[model samples]
Target: MTDPAYQRLGLPVTASPFAVLRAAVRALHPDTRAVRGFRAARKRFYRQMLCAHAARQAAGDRLTG
Candidate 1:
């Protein structure tokens, strides 16, 4: 079966999920002045996105079931 996580991000099965998530974070926060700051923001943004995605998925499942 296809991974829901990959589908959620609209990435191909062969793509790295971490890379997809990193690109998303970069798109959201595009003005980083330093590597450390970018890394920190990326981590925080990724966590937030993942949590939001999971919540939406769970809610959809609940509605459909």
Candidate 2:
């Protein structure tokens, strides 16, 4: 069976947790990384996603990633 989280993130099933997060940050575009607002938003978004995913995993729920 495939990992739902990785699949939803468009990452390989073997991807590490960090890789999944990096992908999320990348999704918002790297060019905006130097912008303070975008940088803060990206960090918040990544943190939220990571926490949510981990919570779902702990609950035995299959995340859509």
Candidate 3:
């Protein structure tokens, strides 16, 4: 099944995860290092939440404001 969290972020889970992440990062116009750092940070945060709680709890936080 596709990851609902990614879908909520407007990402297609059907595509390769890295590709989706790279595209999203590029859309932000971040430098290569910044993109890598952001991805690393996201991975760490999600890992901690998943280990301590659940994937649902670590859901994507989308701000529309």
Predicted model with the maximum TM-score: 2
Clashes of 2: 0
lDDT per residue for candidate 1 within 1-65, as digits (tens), equals 33354345664333444666664655563456346647876677677655555565666678889
Question: Judged by lDDT, which candidate is best?
Answer: 2
Model 2 over residues 22-59: C-alpha lDDT tens digits?
87766665577767867777777777667655654655
Off by over 4 Å in 1: 1-23, 29-34
Give the winner by lDDT: 1 or 3: 1
Q: Which is better, 1 or 2, measured by lDDT?
A: 2
| Ten contiguous residues with the weakest lDDT in model 3 | 56-65
| Candidates 1 and 3 compared by TM-score, better number | 1
TM-scores vs. true structure, each candidate: 0.52, 0.55, 0.27
lDDT of each: 0.56, 0.62, 0.45
